[model samples]
Target: MTSQLSADYKVDHFQKKATVVGLVGAAVFLFAAVAPYIFATDVTSAWIKLFYLISLATTWNLLAGYAGMVSVGQQAYIGLGAYGIFVFNDMGLDPYSSVLVASVAVGIIAFPISYVAFRLRGGYFAIGTWVIAEATRQIVIRFDSLGSGRGRSITTYTEDAIYRNLFTYWVALAIMGLAIVATFYLLRSRLGVALQSIRDNEVAAKSMGIKVSQTKRIVFVVAAMGAAAAGGIICLQGLGVASPNTIFGVNYSAFMIFMVLIGGIGTIEGPIIGAIIYFLMDYYFSQMGLWYMVVLGVLAILIMLFLPRGVWGEISHRFNFKVFPVGHQVQPLFPGIKLKKK
Candidate 1:
């Protein structure tokens, strides 16, 4: 006698849990979007800071955690983004419009700069980026119209305080949303796989026919644009660049590192979590002066020693669930089916 049997299977990237999380997240985002209407301007205005911080952290994490590019010079783009505002604003564009235009300009500029930065690898690449940032700062300051190391204000901003805060808050929220969505989709794409493979093993990624340089350059420019948008938002929030030194300060790089490491590097959710944690700490403890920095340092050390994968990384590892769910999983349509041979 002979018997016939069949087997079936399915592949899935998005899990049920992820769907639930997505719905809840959508609700939260909707609430946040309508916050200006429901909450006081003062309360809604503070979210602008969190929005930019998340934007910065997410881009930095995308660079270092996924692409294996530990750059400490992202402030270069941040400063440029801030200054680009002044350039465009002076050219008769509104400050808000200036932010978008400046970000695109910075992305175009980053393409050529990536060529210079790509020359070195590992620690050299890190140092080269910092050098580039410092050089950029020096060059920017030489332009007397850009405040010459002093500072500048947005002379063309809206006059109403409430409307101004509302607009800025909306822009900030939009930037944060776009950053997260763009990153999520990017990581889900084939290029994201290439980038992660390169991060894990560049030589092997090349052997697999992945165009390492091109992929990295794309990420570089994208990350630059992201940083620039955040920078523009910072400028808008403060009404202008307070000082070139402050806007382009390496401290911003430190903050990026702190957020990515604390939230969990290499994951989309990690940076957001990390940024919120840092934001809370900064809001409450900044008044303590040097002690605030001390606390930050201590917390970083503890997280590294214990939660080496970061808070979200550890949590995800334990639960085996992902809110973003970029990776694929395969399952059998029929749990246990065997073909019989006669």
Candidate 2:
């Protein structure tokens, strides 16, 4: 009645092929970050735009996709980050240093804001966040030192066009890189499991001893800082125009949603893909003015209707491929191998 039982434990987030692809991607992007020094200002500026949008899209995806906190008011953090740059600059910090200040400032603001926003759930939650953003904008506009409604600029650096472009573009790349790395690490940790569990079933997660509120608060704060970092990059790259209307505009949220939706929510690669597509469309069709807007809107609607899980989501589902895998999978350890009898 004696028999042998053998089992091998295997735990891996990334597939072998995905690992190779990721390495290649890292190398390619590393080269792209230095393209500002090698290419024209317009080209570098486009890269800056792409990176910042990717940062925002990724942060928004973490919030709405992993945490099930659908917010339509992320512009609040963005605007706060933009203003933070001004504050830091006024305090005699360099623009690069100000980016850090802006991010921290936004995180601090999100701490209290989360307490209020978390009170409302579902649709009310979305509207509540938006109202908070609007209230923040109104309050910011009352500050004369902030240029009130007229907005402010970053006049700290007096460098040439090349120097300015290279510096800002590099900073944008750095911010985006940090965001992606941070998200990957966070999602691979135990907290990531709690976060996704909460997203899937809040009641069950709570019942399982998951501190839902605390987890969500941490995510909210991280997202705020990430978005604020993006905003700071945008401000620097765009030569600093922190207008309440522009920085706090709902359009930022809309773009974030569109990118995540089209790219695929809940997946890391989705937002990256979505941002590339968006940048391409904007760059090529922007001269068409209103028509371009219509085209983008129509494209987004088509993606939603046809690919509900998003372009990446659909492809991943069909092919079972993940460049940045998060979940576990089981496969045969020795397929077609004959066992020896003892």
Most accurate candidate by TM-score: 1
Query: What TM-score against the true fold does each predicted structure earn?
Result: 0.94, 0.92
Model 1 Cα RMSD, 1 decimal: 4.2
Worst 10 residues of 1 by lDDT: 2-11
Candidates' lDDT values, in order?
0.92, 0.87
After superposition, the stretches of candidate 1 with alpha carbons farther than 4 Å from their true spots are 1-8, 15-23, 337-342
What's the C-alpha lDDT at position 179 in model 1?
90
lDDT of 2 at 244: 75
Error of 2 at 247 (Å): 1.0
lDDT of 1 by residue, 107-198 (tens): 99999999999999999999999999999999999998988989888889999989889888888888898898888878878888999999
**Clashing pairs for predicted structure model 1, backbone only:** none
Among residues 3 or more apart in sequence or in different chains, the pairs in candidate 2 whose N, CA or C atoms overlap within 3 Å are none
Top lDDT hit:
1
